[model samples]
Target: MGETTTGLVPTTVRGEVEGQDLIMWEQLTDAARSGLTNAGFAAPIIDEAFMPNLESARPSF
Candidate 1:
């Protein structure tokens, strides 16, 4: 339902299955072992680092 049938690329991008994005992103980053040291650099390197701001974001509900 989240894909298109007609386009220049002629492709169907299956929509993410529920929370699969978060799960997949986390899975991809699982190889890294983060710690107190260099914590500042760990997140930016991954680019999926939005956890801290997410909690404070305005509640849309």
Candidate 2:
């Protein structure tokens, strides 16, 4: 063993990485939210928006 490294690196470095990951996730989430909204699927009322239309299209006896 020449020089065994030990102990945690640093909280600030780990925090920066976590912050970057959050930023990346936010960007991706925003893009996906926009795509869904454009496609007429509101995030909050997704099922409410499509379920009624689907139900109406079913063969009624």
Candidate 3:
């Protein structure tokens, strides 16, 4: 509880100030997320991503 002109004003950091998960979730929605998190870029983060093995080549006749 904090002081105000007429009463005490209660405030919170969106979900919960102390919880890291909530903070991370909030961060995902924030302005910084425009550059930091890309849902389309997650393909490489997971194992077994599809990519052509450049080393292997067909013998050119």
Candidate 4:
């Protein structure tokens, strides 16, 4: 099964890190993303903190 949750990553993933706000996602600019893709990379690694709602997507135990 599959599901989708939509929101701005920066706002969605914001949290406290060392007592300060932390944004987990570092979305690349279009040029940079294209450059990476052209250079044979799929995409930049995303932090687990930025993972979409897996609890809802996963098959229930």
Q: Could you say which candidate leads in TM-score?
A: 2
lDDT of 4: 0.48
State the RMSD for candidate 2.
Answer: 15.9
Clash number for each model? 0, 0, 0, 0
Give per-model TM-scores. 0.17, 0.31, 0.19, 0.23
The 0-to-1 C-alpha lDDT of every candidate, in the order given, reads: 0.46, 0.57, 0.50, 0.48
Ranking by lDDT: 2, 3, 4, 1
Error of 4 at 25 (Å): 7.4
RMSD of 4: 12.7
Per-residue error for 45 in candidate 2, Å, reads 9.9
**TM value for model 2:** 0.31
> What TM-score does candidate 3 reach?
0.19
The deviation in Å at residue 60 for candidate 1 is 6.4
Q: Which digits, one per residue and each the tens of the lDDT, describe model 2 over residues 1-61?
A: 2443452244544535543233443566777867766685233446566787778779989
lDDT of 1 by residue, 1-61 (tens): 4564442243355763333234443454434444432377433433354665665675978
Comparison by TM-score, 1 against 2, better one = 2
Query: Candidate 2: misplaced stretches above 4 Å?
Result: 1-27, 38-46
Clashing pairs in 4: none
